[model samples]
Target: MNTTKAQILDGKALAKKIQSDLQQKIATLEPNIGRPPGLAVLMVGDNPASAVYVRNKEKACSRVGIASVGKHFSAQVTQEELTAEIHRLNENDRVDGILVQLPLPDGLDSVALLHEIDPQKDADGLHPVNLGHLVRSETGLRSCTPAGVMKLLAEYNIALSGKKAVVVGRSILVGKPITLMLLEANATVTIAHSRTQDLTAVCRQADILVAAVGKPEMITPDMVKPGAVVIDVGINRVTDSDGKSRLVGDVAYDAVAEVASYITPVPGGIGPMTVAMLLSNTVLSYQEKMTI
Candidate 1:
């Protein structure tokens, strides 16, 4: 008897489909709306990875006919100044969505600045008001990464209802929101983290396993249930032999792919979907504003 290997969840292809749909939607909306939806990106300092992410987001906006406005600030910008800029964007009629790139300089308070953005324009969906709406199961924009994960699962026709789902990590950005979204879909969800006892046993019970623990190669084959769906959300960079750096996911993909029924690959899986969802949210925000 031969065992079947897991199917790869191709996020890039799915994201392209979503982006194309959004482009068509924008075309229909332009005449009534007078112009394309606009997204304002506020990037602080010059973190290499953050720069890449912001650039990709802008490019996505351009592809979908959304106007992109970028405000790049120096590392030394003050918290008060950042808040003032957020207020300015919030008041701009042309700006439909606002995103402040994360990891501000050492002294800046990210959480405080998050609160300053008008919830209607919070493109990243990190504001307390939007998060509270999500907690209450009300309609509001969702965090891009978690929203993207749900979109990926739905695209593959994976039913979350009645499944035993486990999310490893409880970060506000990814883990907590995804767990809630799964629960909203009627999946029994468990959130585990670094301090979880008998973590392997807990993970092995999951029908759908999500690894967002931010550590490389943490979810091995031993921790997975055979035929479970594995979603790898951690993108860790490591130096291979000969000092070459490469991106690797939290799940040991090569080993876990042998046991799991389906898996998402690093770089190509969850990453692209995030930017796609952000564009979706921006368009949705713009449409919502028009109706109000």
Candidate 2:
């Protein structure tokens, strides 16, 4: 029996290199622009996970010499109030990127707020204009998570052209955007969701399998094709049978790693890549401003 383990897709290492490059790029650009690139991350409520994510983003911005104008608000902040804040940031000359963290407090409309951000400054790349550009395959900012996934694949020189790609989620956050991106690369893509029939069979058909279903260890060995490359985008916290709390992806890592040719580990995989792409987006926006 051939038992060669899959080569690990080391996103953490790639993210570090990306940051280093971005930092050097910023160092050269700052003197010309008269100000460093600024990214404004507007965070509401106090969700612990969101808090940690926001903190990490600000720290990364600092390391790359980008200014962090992060705003914190209570869970009870009104929708009108949030919209006004977004508008203020839109007009701020120094701020090149604006992102409202996900999973906002109940009764708030995240979709409406996202629409208010200027497309050029939409760092999360969730705004309608940016997404439309993605559909048309035009030049524009793309969603951070999906952009990160594509970058990691490129870094590893994974061949997507004419390959069968399967994305196991339908959210705008990862699945839909990623499917479009894969198609752009000439990958015949299928989007499998919670309601899909014969999910395992669909997943097995993929040459490049992407899991972003937000379920812990949902993708198993049986669902993966032998010699396939797997990208795990879901990050879920769960207590194992031993009662230990840990972070795990949608793929059952250990078992599936044995079956696939390449796989990305949870925590170290999509997470940092997503942040790196966010910073990259900010820098791109800043550079575009110089030309305009």
Candidate 3:
């Protein structure tokens, strides 16, 4: 029943370009800095998907000339032990960034652990200091995923100024920060969540719609306004008719693509951009150390 076609946002291409630029920049700056930028990604337990993400981040760091000083711990690793490691990384001069992988095994106080990480080296940008800086529009490491969304939008020359932007979801990771970022770009932002009534009606009011609710195929064609730009930040794995697992974004891609003017594909879109931004933040922290 779909007929019209929309242009792909192509975040994958932009991410590749960003990594290449970072690689070159690192090559040039290493001599003066005396060491490559280092990012420590601490992962606990063996969540298969989390492992994959950590591995991809390490690979990206290596390609960009950032040192991966990451670590892994068993699911039963105690909070005290993790805190000690975070403290050590925070003080190490070589470590420019420190990130605690999320959804830590049960009984771990992730928020408390996040609080322990030095604000300067908070690579994931989830630290209160960094988040506060974001709220105040100061220069600091930003949440990678949200920053990536903005970067991709800019890369495609999409105008956000005065645009009606609706973001579905209220999570701190993507929704809130992204709303602030869009507001900074002069876009009018409305954050809709589960409590929002008539979600489709609210979504249809946007010139720019961002779906970060983590629900697969939640945003169908009818929810999208024709000619709107849709950014899908949700990645969900679901089995298909063939019983094969595949990744899908919050928006129903095929159906929505027929309505929106532009859209981002899940596997190739936000995933890579988030990693790229993380590396970028690590390098930023690295540069700051050199000037100190």
TM-score of each: 0.98, 0.98, 0.98
Give the C-alpha lDDT of model 3. 0.94
Write model 2 residue lDDT over 127-244, tens digit each, in one string. Answer: 9999999999999999999999999999999999999999999999999999999999999999999899999999999999999989999999999999999999999999979999
lDDT scores of the candidates, listed in order = 0.94, 0.95, 0.94
For model 2, give the 10-residue run with minimal summed lDDT. Answer: 1-10
Q: How many clashing pairs does model 1 include?
A: 0
Off by over 4 Å in 3: 1-3
Which residue segments of model 2 deviate by more than 4 Å? 241-243
Stretches of candidate 1 exceeding 4 Å from the true structure: none
Tens digit of per-residue lDDT, candidate 3, span 88-179: 99889999999999889889999999999999999999999999999999999999999999999999999999999999999999999999
RMSD of each: 1.1, 1.0, 1.2
